[model samples]
Target: MDSSQRIYWTAFYTKPRNEKKAAERLTSKGFEVYCPTRTVLKQWSDRKKKVTEPVFTSYIFAKVDETSRLEILKDTSIVSNVRWLGKPAIIQEKEITEIKSFLEDFPRSELAHGDFQAGNKVQIDSGALSGQSGVIRRTQGNKAFLIIASLGLELYAEISLNHLKKVG
Candidate 1:
């Protein structure tokens, strides 16, 4: 296929609570769609049941070429493509594979919102300091400066914000 006809995995923002519907419609039209979801136990006033919901609220991914992208936007449930620098954000296949693998391993895992701020205690989730808890001294862009107390001394290190999770 030519470059214009090459398939790309692009993310789209959907109408509130319309992710599954959009995925269905797109698939029915012969477009490839992916909507990552998780099963959770939800409790109502008098009942509890397992419900599957989209992992990313109001978001779904579809594989489409440039020509079909216009057709995708015509769906009422799709608001618009997720954009970066005025262009549709293209998602890497490897990243999508990782997400699938992660969900398979931890089906009930919840996504944590990382709004790192100074003085918040967080635990390193990966890299050399994985599992170590530290207090954020400050944040700069995508990096967090942490003060890790160990062996009666405070050790300082800068870690990527992606590797840290807020600790309660």
Candidate 2:
């Protein structure tokens, strides 16, 4: 990457089960990559119980110097795409920090991601996930999983129930 150009986060397609592999390779080479994941239950044939695994599979966000875009994208195991307005998506470091903070602050059961079939639009007015907006996907018993989409990727990440509510 050229010194004058800036690094931006981008979405990549990885070989099945290759998300961790891609991240390891890029970060080891001095690139910043993010593969946000959460554990979910996977029902197996041989087991009566479920296994916890990644929510989003084979997808990651990477930051590459504008100059290194070409070289960095040459990995045969990963395919890349610019996600922000045709340019590589520049995810503010602060945003990632906030996400990390949220994970540490909230328990896994506190987040939810379901179809918003019956809820109100909401804006997270404050806290780590402030500025996020979504509709209540629904509640399972007493817990809720407010659904919000990452504007950059247009992909949804279930957020903390306490962070959202009816907007109007």
Candidate 3:
């Protein structure tokens, strides 16, 4: 591929509960897709069962070149690619690797969310809180206090240190 056709990883927003479908469609169309999933055990009145679900709801990653950007956007399940400065957001390979490594270690860890705080800005790449951005208030052992801002509220959550990556 030429320079203009060099492939980059991009995050695409899917319709509600359509992350897997969107990934499948993108894959079937010969594009590399990533939608991390984990198995979680749930309890009910009768019994408990393990269910596999997407780590990041309404979002999936795709490896595509600039020339194929419009083609990938044609999928119905994909609402649009996540953008930065009016352009499609390009996710770094290192961030992707960190997310994969996190999933391998904490396949079933619960994700916590909260608002901003005073510390280094970070992003949760995997788990229930994938796609959330926050600040690291502190870290004790393997646990981190994350302050995530959402819906105009500052929320605080304690998460694993391994699940976080410094956001650029």
Candidate 4:
């Protein structure tokens, strides 16, 4: 029974795109839950609408103590065992927090990704590429990729909000 209520990598089988619902159910049970989702733009005949979709498909995260494993397993929405190396895996709370933070702060921070594409000017806002200029790309999910336009190649790295800032 850790005070942090350590996180676990659960291999839950959701109801075919019902991951969010399942996560919510578990959350209400007093378990710390995480289901990373993003709003995707869908163009309809009438207009464009942003629909919330799960990033990891059927996967969801939960934080609990060892004693709660049985209750979690008994959960109606969670269909499979949480796993790691052939056993129920215990993921540290730190990793869950980091991923959550990245999703939340994506708007303000700069982003970088590997593989360059056309018409991108290279710019590196952080790391070895920091302060360097490169091709910038406005990609899906508000992610930006820095590439070398001349080479038509993107830097071989994918960074989220954690290590991103637009180069001045």
Question: TM-score winner among the candidates?
Answer: 1
lDDT of 4 by residue, 38-119 (tens): 7655445576566787878877776655566667777777777567688677776677778778888773222223233434
C-alpha-based local distance difference test score of model 4: 0.61
Better of 1 and 3 by TM-score: 1
TM-score of each: 0.64, 0.52, 0.61, 0.56
Best by lDDT: 1
Question: What lDDT tens digits, residue by residue, belong to model 2 across residues 1-168?
Answer: 456476555577677887877778978888777776654333344532333333358777776676666666787668665466776666777777776687667645433433223466877766777887766666543235566767554434455444555576
The CA lDDT at 110 in model 2 is 39
Instruction: Sort the predicted structures by lDDT, highest score first.
Output: 1, 3, 2, 4
* Residue-level lDDT for 80 in candidate 3: 89
* List of clashing residue pairs for candidate 2: 1-67, 1-68, 112-145
In model 1, which residue pairs have backbone atoms overlapping below 3 Å?
Answer: none
Better of 1 and 4 by lDDT: 1
TM-score of 4: 0.56
RMSD of 1: 8.4
User: Residue 40: error of model 2 in Å?
Assistant: 3.0
What lDDT tens digits, residue by residue, belong to model 3 across residues 1-168? 577787899998989999888888788888888999987654466765666789998999888898677788899998888999998999998888899999998867453222223497999988999989998887654467988999999999998766787786
Poorest stretch of ten by lDDT in candidate 4: 107-116
lDDT per residue as tens, model 1, 1-168 = 688888889999999999999999999999999999997655466765667999999999998899888899999999999999998899999988898899999876343323688999999999999999999998765588999998888999999877889989
CA lDDT of each candidate?
0.88, 0.62, 0.81, 0.61
Flag regions of model 2 displaced more than 4 Å.
1-4, 48-52, 107-168
